[model samples]
Target: MSTIEDAAVWLAAADPDPIHARRWIGSARIILLPLGERWSAVKVSEHQGLAAAAALRGPSIHDPSGQCVYFLVAPHTVWDAPGSECLGESYWLTVPTPAVKEPPGPYWLRAPDGSGQLVDAEELRAQLGARSVSAAGAASVKQP
Candidate 1:
């Protein structure tokens, strides 16, 4: 975040549920942006008031939990700048965090010729669980 207050503003504006906000906003940023665009995110610390924003660099690789993981090349810098640094944290919201009971956002799959098709959330949950889809909008996952 640019200013300390900006972080607060972001937190305030996000969904009331912290976990939901993280998943929804985070997923939105991941799926909507260009396949390889990187971004900075100030991860709000549940234990504390604030922590430095991580690079949140992505379209990288998906984490084991099916959440896409990125490097927080540096901290305190939320503005997007090429080659910036951010802080990466694996202890998101502290472990044992509740799995998002709701769908993060709409999931899209790419077709053979390069077309994006929207898919249902249930379909997404199954595919993600199976790790069957390689890349979003990259290929279909058995067309079911």
Candidate 2:
């Protein structure tokens, strides 16, 4: 619905600490998984994972190089408190290394939980690291 850049600017000013992350996941390149609606939980699966979010809003690749630095920041479409404080959800963001091999398509970025372990959102937690955060106005239930 909106450009990725616009989302970035909004995210940048998200919280007291808005800078999502920078990553070098595995051998895959990763980027932001843009979604019009806030996500409740994200994981590293195909059917039920962050990849689904990627399907909603993605192809947000900055580069396809694993040799260089790439940002895997969380989408910053959140509700902010004063002083640019984020009071909302964002998955685990990272700065994925460039892809050793060229990424196939948006699919790579869509790999759930950043399959290939290449990407993550900004603030939220990884399924493996800590508990995942769920979006508001949604079910209280969670998934792996």
The candidate 2 region of ten consecutive residues with least summed lDDT is: 79-88
Specify the highest-lDDT model's number.
2
User: Which residue ranges in model 2 land beyond 4 Å of their true spot?
Assistant: 18-41, 46-92, 95-144
| Tens-digit lDDT string for candidate 2 (10-55) | 3333223345422213223444433322322233323223323333
What RMSD does each model have against the real structure? 18.2, 13.7
Query: Which ranges of candidate 1 are over 4 A from the true structure?
Result: 1-62, 80-144
Q: Go through the candidates in order and give each one's C-alpha lDDT.
A: 0.26, 0.31
User: What is the C-alpha lDDT profile of model 1 across 29-53, one tens digit per residue?
Assistant: 3211111112222222221111111
